[model samples]
Target: MNVLLVKDDCGRSRKTCHMPTHTAIIALTKGGKQLAQRLKTLVPGSEIIPNKGKIHQTFAQAWQDHDSLICIMATGIVVRSIAPLLQDKTVDPALVVCDEQGRFAVSLLSGHLGGGNALAQKVADVLGGQAVITTASDVLGHTALDLWCRDMGLAVTDKQGLTRVMAKLVNTGSVTLYSEYPLPPLPQDIIPSRTLDAADLLVTSRIRQKENIVLLHPKALVAGIGCNRNTPAKEISEALDHACRTHQLARESVRNLASIDLKSDEPGLLAFAHAQNLPLDFYSPDQLNQVEGVAASAAVLRATGAKAVAEPAAILSSGGGPLLVQKMKFPNVTVAIAEILQPFPTLF
Candidate 1:
């Protein structure tokens, strides 16, 4: 992941962020320039982002370009400027702060899933300072919800449920970590359960609705799509997005896109997969037609020489799991969702 280091002054403050792994730095003048040059020695791939007048603007620009941020300036200044860009724990980049003297490394924001807390610890390790982390779960020695989901590669279907369930974990209440999949050792605060009625945290791919239950969907869903020639990638994307949302499926859980090999070079389908950053797997018409129980479409069979493309491709790509979404047609695109098979419903 790309890291952005923003510094106002030199000294240990700038050096604290110049970890050997950092990729770039943004420095305001007044001693920041020389620090950037010196930082180049320690971090090979790191580039110095030159800044003079408005440090806030440079920092803002880095917010979009980088995966995580480390500010070697006052925490208040960093917070005020980044307040506008703070979205949520899932989408926001990790942010850390260090004083000019580098006495303390603080995780200012996105400490859990975004990895701010770990970055702070790394900074402290480098500068021989204290890593200041104040998140309740971290302080209380409980498993952080965001960290747990991230570690398990699960995507929360409903973020609202996650907030409430996290509150429970932080408040000394137990959370049932239900997984049919064998998980590693879990924290004391999380216990395994089998039923939704007894669960506060559920890890599964099946659609479920419950209040105050954190639902983590594993990245085990596979999608298959078929689109008309020259169809805009945007429309295909929107159609798949709608299908996932409407079915209460986690988009992050989608492993890849599948389609008939006949369209191996189809630009529209390839564009959609590229936009989603998922691999596109294509099978020949014979392969797609062999998958049993795919929804039949006379038109698709006539046009593509396959009885069904979307549903069968999805099931086959997912290694023949049950289909979560049957073929859904919208505009010039057809989409389907299937869960990647696992031994159990929930995994540890």
Candidate 2:
């Protein structure tokens, strides 16, 4: 994780610059020079970035570029400088603030979602100071949903639902948690319920349009693709979307896209996979044909020496699972989907 250190005053902070080498320090000149020297002594390999322009602009850029920001400046100054750029918790970087003396590290924003609270503790440890974390979930010992989702690699489907449920949970302790996936040891606030009909928060890989239900999609599905030569990338993408839509599958759960080795060099297929940010796995015709239970097509068998393209590819990619979608032939592409089978028990 990249960290950016911004200090407005340099002279006094020079000795305190003994931060870790991975940290990038933005030193405001004049008063910042001495602080930079001090920091350099403390942190041997950490590089210092000269404050080139407006402080707010630097803060904004650092927020985008780094995973965390350690502001060795006044909390008020850091707050105002970063206020304009403050956005959603899901994407914002962890923000930690320390006094000019580097005493009392404070987690000012994104305590859980961006790991600000954790960073505050680390910074406080480095400075021989105290970490002040004010997030209610952390202070009260309740579950931080955003942090949990991030750690589990689950994507939030209904962020508004999450906020609404969180308000109810924090204010009235009225939220039920249910999951179709494996359960982790949860806080008392997130009580398990048996049914989605009674849940405020739902965790699954399926698409749901119900109001006030925050869906946490686990990465579980693999998609297989078979396209004719010269097929446009858009067609391949659209076909996959259609397949997912038909099955009410959350497209976010797609782990990767699999195709035959013959299509490995197919520009359109490769481009589509890259654009979708889905890893593409290409299997040999022998490997594809080895899989059973796929509907055979004469044209596909003759062309690629495989019984089917999409079905076998999907099954193989998922490491042998029941096909969630059989080979679906579109005008330019054939698509299939399969859920990766796991030993997740349904109940206690």
Candidate 3:
């Protein structure tokens, strides 16, 4: 895939396969234009959209091009211009409204998951103003569930359930929390539940279909794989999928792939990893030998100088974590899975 060069907040160049618009600032009046220009310099990776006199047309053009939009116009004007382009909150860009005098930055749309509140605060900081955030959780000084999921890289299973749980959090100021892995410090509003049945929010790799519960799947599993030479990519993918399904694991939680260095250039493994957008790590035979308690195969030892490939590689990639799935063999593939145990974000 072709790559693009992007600049970060520190003005450092980074390579990316896709170039998403970082930020776009649009303004109408002269004072608003001046504020937009100042923000272009203050906010990293931000650019001012040239106003062509037709403010609605400019907003329409920017709505599809940017991940974040800062409108230096009246809040009503912004709402009207973006109404037609509005879609699901998950897909909509961060919308922030700032006064022409740079007195206040309002998080008008997509505040939690879209990061509009953070952007508003940043703009206010740069302009010496105050940020107006109206989210119920933020106003009540409680941890926003959606923002927590975003920061922890969790995938919510049910959107409507999450909304209901957020409302419950704001109304009652507490929700039961359950996790399969260790967690960071909990706030007063998050009461830990000992069982999944009694929990209102769950963090696990298991699939659940119950209602009135917000389920979040963490990217915590590492799949180690070994395949016969010249195996097809489709076969390898199906083998992994079968393994995950058989073990009742969520496919979204498989973080990466691990294999021996001898198969580093294997076309099947490379293609599967690329299609899944998962990182692939390779280890030497000596490193694999260091991992004990794995099923040793004489044929694998003779061919690759390692007694086991899939099980040890999974353990190594997971930072020496215990295996969740022991080695399973298919016609042309061997697979193992391990939970990645590491430090989580303590900010929550």
Candidate 4:
């Protein structure tokens, strides 16, 4: 949790300045020294970076580095500094604004906008301050549809589109969710208005519903793995992380865990497959032989007792191809990640 703190117009370090992990404090006045000392007492491991110039420079630098912003300055200064950064969707970080006294913490931008609201609450709790959360669903104690989609590892293709849908949901007190399979149970307070069949949904899920409904697709990211017998679970986990980052795919989107049948019972693969909460599908030797363009090594073939030389390639094709491949040296394993591409119907 990286935080960026800015000084207020009064040019004073509030006694409430406490640092957490990966914290950076930027001040427009010389007051940063006092804040840094207080932060060191609160968070020994925190890093405090001070600037006594314009607030916008600090904001721009923080934005460029993609750090979450926690403004301890005036509300107007915080607002002005963040306005430009908000326009570009790709670079925005969670933005939280707190008074110099730290009595009230407000989530001004990225409130469910980009996870700022949740971060604000967490920061407020740490400081023993009041979190002035304004997101309507959160204030009403209703399940937030966008947050739900994020939790399910589904991407929200259009933010404005989701906004419109949420507005409808707020007014109607009803929204539909579509899925090809039965969804995991939702909060009991949420009642389904109706279930209709339509091809358009905001997120990934096999189910479809009529207008004014939210759709949750099953996991769309597939993990195709090839591991050695009795491989360590840590190696497999690291391989999965590497592959996911290499492919620029969210770890949460991983829907299916796949491997060769010979290694299905391997403890490492089994544990990793289960931990991700995805279905583990094993491919038989014959099935491994069927995938085209697979590069198998003699060592892999002999170790797995498979007729084919490349177990990783087979796993990818079986799981779905154009997969991200990660070769492990310790356990002599390889992992692949594939992103499911689904066609969505236009919702007018």
Candidate 5:
């Protein structure tokens, strides 16, 4: 998808990826299979995987492909089947276990970051059961740090620090939050801090890291490129890295890329976008010229129809958002960065 959209209070569309969209529902017993069939219909992009008696083989085959797995079987069966396939929680798929009677849905693994808790709750709603969430934050009725970051489309920069912060938050029952952008009313446990130094959790695109501080980088930045013909992907990558590093911005915060339509067929640019798995938006000269506050370049105008490529393209692609970094030149490439305003969802 080019840009994932979430509706704001005024119904304005904003870019956001809430959670895993693909799910695999697996069942071993006849009664369990019936429950899985019902779930497959209610869950979007979910498929029922009939157990062929080899539970390990079935799990191994579907482990890498699916974002989440719902096993309609005993919790012990699921725990044993997926134990060997468990990896880092960040990349591990969410696992939910449901009883054959459909009386309880348990978030078995990756409760927060991998969205296992949310999936369990959803499954419970569909089956008219109780969702068993054991995560400390959920049990205590406090803000779930990892879930909040995931819902906001923010990447955790420091995994170790996040764990520490989460432990402390659960113990102390509160955390101070600092953000570059304005946030909506927060949970009772999350108090907004005016300064970054006083906060335990930070929401920003800037690359800030410290001991015991959890940095959440939102995917809200767009990069615009102006490159010479046949500019290698390495050169473009280096230019982007240099710009972000020099400006203290996190590369993980970049949402997509933008460029003039004249370079739509450029192989190097296409390769770079594909490698990064980022959507590249191309605009015509007329569209670029309509954007204001872009630096004009006579050379760019002569080469392409647009007076400016990097600056105007960034501005237009960001929906007229303010520029964070004006055109910065490199050996064979130029880059400009813009911030797309992200709306904060209701946190309470």
Candidate 6:
């Protein structure tokens, strides 16, 4: 993965982003050599790009070239630099903000799947500072629904169904059960679809063609996340990938993307959410909070207030297993994806 490090104000110009398959580090400053030196020590082999103008100018230039952005500056500067880069079509690099003192590191964007969350943690570890991570699943250290699907080798056939199942799991910690064949009872709903092909049925239960059976299980929740305007889709995708890798899960089982009502119209997020045939579930902040064990970040808490732990936490907590996917970043935005899992039906 190519990482970009930008520091403004270094006297000389160095283009490390051009290196073959390496992470680029751009240091933004008003012409300071110290920043460059500091970044070199922090991220070895990282390309250092210097901009002597405002942070936005540096971002404008480097924003188009990097996969992830780490800001070793104050929070205000970090926010100002990225303000202009936010957009729908662009997969924004994961954004991390760190103070010069490096006392606390915050992942302002792409905390879950986008890698910013993980990156922030890594930077904090390196700097010997506290990484203020706020993702619910990370704090809880439990398997999410998407992670479960990936682990079990199942495919998501219906995004809507998956979303519904996840929401219920987060809210009530359980889901209604249903099935079509004489399969062993599962903990959740197991509605057999006539349109489902043999391949769709990963487990064989009493081979009935069209029967309606119901099972209820508590471990079938899912997670859903959204990104800021223009956040890179790639960042979100990477986050999901990292989540899966961290949990040793698979990718084929993810079912849907969840977000607030406002983000439902975001073209970039919608494109990703729909592409996987993942259902898009939009809820109010209040509705989101029904999920248990979800950690709320300052950004998510501020935006949604008491809603839910932002969209990502709800998805992460609701999902029963590890994370199925990570966040993908676009020009300026990122998103999270996951799958829901239920018990395999057996007929004997």
Model 4 clashing residue pairs (backbone)? 179-207, 180-206, 180-207, 204-217, 205-216, 205-217, 205-218, 296-309, 296-310, 297-309
Sort the predicted structures by TM-score, highest score first: 5, 3, 2, 1, 4, 6
lDDT of 1 by residue, 236-297 (tens): 88998899989987777787788877776677766666556667667768878888877899
**In candidate 1, which residue pairs get closer than 3 Å at backbone N, Cα or C atoms, i.e. clash?**
179-346, 180-346, 181-346, 181-347, 183-348, 261-283
lDDT of each: 0.74, 0.74, 0.86, 0.57, 0.84, 0.50
RMSD (CA, angstroms), candidate 2: 10.0
For model 1 the TM-score comes to 0.78
Cα lDDT of model 3 overall? 0.86
Ranking by lDDT: 3, 5, 2, 1, 4, 6
Query: What global local distance difference test value does model 5 have?
Result: 0.84
Task: State how far residue 234 of model 1 sits from its true place (Å).
Answer: 4.1
Of the candidates numbered 4 and 5, which has the greater lDDT value?
Answer: 5
Better of 3 and 5 by lDDT: 3
The candidate that wins on lDDT is 3
TM-score of 3: 0.84
Tens digits of per-residue lDDT, candidate 4, 213-315, equal 4444446656667766787878888877776566555565566666666665678766665555455656666666666555656776676655442334324
Query: Each prediction's Cα RMSD?
Result: 9.3, 10.0, 5.0, 13.6, 4.2, 21.8
Pick the winner on lDDT between candidates 3 and 4: 3
Q: Model 1 scores what on Cα lDDT?
A: 0.74
10 residues in a row with least lDDT, candidate 5: 10-19
- lDDT of candidate 4 at residue 157, scale 0 to 100: 45
For model 3, the superposed segments whose C-alpha errors exceed 4 Å read 1-21, 52-61, 209-211, 228-236, 265-277, 298-303, 330-333, 341-348
Q: Which stretch of 10 consecutive residues in model 4 shows the poorest summed lDDT?
A: 10-19
lDDT of 3 by residue, 166-250 (tens): 8889999889999987888777898999988889999987777766678788888989999999898999999999999999888
lDDT of 5 by residue, 58-143 (tens): 99988987889999888888888888999888889999999988899999888888889989999899889999999998998888
Index of the highest-TM-score prediction: 5
C-alpha lDDT (0 to 100) for residue 244 of candidate 4: 59
